[model samples]
Target: MRTLLQAVLSAMLLALCITATTQANERYIVKFKEGKESAVKAALDAQGAKLALDLPKHNAAAFSLPAQALTGLSHNPNVEYVEQDAKRYLMSQTVPYGIPLVQADQVSDSVTANIKVCIIDSGYDLAHEDLSGNRVEGANDSGTGNWFTDENHHGTHVAGTIAALSNDVGVVGINPHGNLNLYIVKVFNADGWGYSSGLIAALDVCEAAGAKVINMSLGGSIKSRTEDAAFAAAETAGILSIAAAGNDGNSRYSYPASYRSVVSVAAVDENKQHADFSQYNSQVELSGPGVGVLSSVPMGTALVAATSVANHDYLAIAMEGAPTGIASGVLIDCGSGEQQCDAAGKVCLLQRGNISFADKVLACEQGGGVAAIIYNNTAGQLNGTLGTTVTAIPAVGVTADDGAAMLLDVGNDATVAIGPGNYAYFDGTSMATPHVAGVAALVWSHFPLCTNKQIRAALQQTAEDLDTAGRDNYTGFGLVQAKAAADYLALNGCTAGGGNNTCKGKHCR
Candidate 1:
């Protein structure tokens, strides 16, 4: 039986398709009044609350207090508000097109060991080869077991997009530099579910660990006051929060992301258009490549691959297995009325046009074709699925350029090989969120002196404005541009090109 995630992927695959934390430790954000530092500590110690973070900048501290002592801690005269730390889970990446689209490739040389970016989601896979040397030890789990391990693959994927190593194999991250160190904060469990308190605890841990940026790919419809206070406090402590603008394809807002304190990111495809499912509203601050993004998955999993073209290698997604390998053969165009073209024992190539993906593959199968390769007639790579049609021939998708090149070499042989180290395509505002986070890391790493507010301004002011010019709901300030933001920061110090100060609101977070 297919799980809900699998079922959702199936429906989206047909459309080109598709696409936390720990528990425990009664977490609370104890905000203290001015000059109440010693009193705050005494209250925390008296309540037996283990201090997780000491935020001197915000005059507050986060602690894991016993649930029974919550009332007493709240009654403290110096304590401003003691709220239960909320839980946030891993939102689930693709070389992801957003990387290059946002010009992250241009700033590869700006590596920094001092810039710590926290992925506050499902913990990470510490053993991931691509993430080696880029991770910081001593992950914060908020009392959840399994510490920094990513059982859900979502956190690992998000981590890969932000700072996958500059290795030869696997997907490269937005910031391929070796300097940016990733700190994992596991708030969600193996099931990808978490609470508000857990998230608050993770934020405390992030600030304590000296994380300059926090990337949250997960979100919920309901907003928690405790969660808002934590985020607001993190902002006050000079930590930039980036989040996904929901994936419901509606105007309804999601917490943390929709909060004014965090930078909300929307999803876009390779075509630089709004994704069908990406949520939109005034809260959306920016956009990134989120559709059919190809990136790293966990190790030992079945990795997808293909080898048929000469000059260029295409990221092929296997929709249906062909059982046996299809050796080189004359490519026959079996599109539209030409379904009868002698595809017997040959690799049938079809262009995405009038017929449905299933119909095209069925045509190839009917013609005795050993395999089928469908290339997109339009821009971007083909990501169509054949539903559940059990065709004897294997089917795969290729980019429009690769298909055109293959057409030019109609007589050349193509090969389809299935092996390990699988790369996948996923879609969501969750995927877009990391792109912005990564770009922010790149800029912040380049200019360590820039405050979190300045970093946010650089990103928003220098973004590639789309939709209705200035800042729109769908594309926000347009797609995030790493080099552009970096250049802006270097030249203007968070000031817009028009010489206007972009970092205005101190309480916007």
Candidate 2:
């Protein structure tokens, strides 16, 4: 009886050990010796490893296997090396700096005057706090979902740039007073793409809704004659149409924007420099702030990180994939964060470079850091992302100047807070499109009696010419200026250019 009981206990123990070992699987990339790919794969298969990816060109294969099996695999003559399969992330969006750059802030609140601007892109987030207060309406042509709920954040971001509420918490749009009657026509689905037929149908919806300006921050390489006819008709109907000039950074023409009837908007940086990725062509009509443009995304999908030391708040941007929480501790400098330091129970202040943001944050967390702050090695802001690497501590980025100042105040109590917020930074001519559209609405509201052609002419004439001086392919007539365009119209009546004086009400007072 004693022998039988001992045998049972031994079997139970062995089963538990094997189960634990099998559950401890981790993903890794295993490189094989030249001409030994098949042998290495077979050996890995014998070790109970599951193959994930096969890269014959690089002589590598990704697998998920027991951590204990790594040693034996590395010893195989066919195996070259084994390393962890690291994660990668998309480029993160940043804050909006285009409002004042495009002179939208200089326009008066009365300039809004209930002008209707239609957005045709991904669906809008009707529930967004910054957008919920506005008189917004929409219709869904894409087979995705409802027009009010945005599964993809592109439309919501674009809408915020044109009309986010002037609420103090989140971002404020060009028409910040919530005065414009926004008509959203969701042509693009959650995949960030749509058919040309869907877009033309959306134009019909815009016209029916009585929208005076249509913002099309989307395009394709192929130009459809039917789509061109639709835009031309929309233009003839006195509706101002604005579109992105593509982000290809080439001279190739992008549809809709390339059409004669549409205002093609190119992207420029904060300093009014043409973006390298912004397409340059004779069709480009105007330029606006597009690079690092901060605007509203879906609520809770993004956040703004705030950092402060000794009651001094410094401008900061949250690292992508950072946790939403607050971490406060004594600040400790961890130069480059390449090597571990005495960061235990403190906020680790690391300088950017020499390693990935994830590695730096990992080193801090490994050393028991309560939070992490990475300063730029260069002059501009350090916008870093952690990919899929998650940490227990909060991580934020600051400008080089702020980072330098913080380095001097080491050992001070600092706080890094990232919580629920709705704003994000996005780059592309898609971002520039909204700026021009919003400016058009703002200027048109003041000159309601002016024809669409007249308003278009005023904007082109008043633009701050950039790049190759007067009307070049890069920046066209240059940056769209809200106050300048408004001033030009005020000085010259609607008939100053050519169109008949359609004045009936108070004319450009």
Pick by lDDT: which candidate is best? 2
Per-candidate TM-scores read 0.67, 0.74
- Superposed by TM-score, candidate 2 places the C-alpha of residue 259 at a distance from the truth, in angstroms, of 2.5
Tell me how many clashing residue pairs each candidate has: 24, 4
- Please, what are the lDDT tens digits per residue for candidate 1 over residues 314-387? 55655533332334344676755246557876778888888777788788878877677888887766666566
**TM-score of the candidate numbered 2?**
0.74
Each model's lDDT: 0.71, 0.81
Q: Put down candidate 2 lDDT per residue, 400-466, tens digits, no spaces.
A: 8999999988988787766555666677899999999999999889888888988899889889999
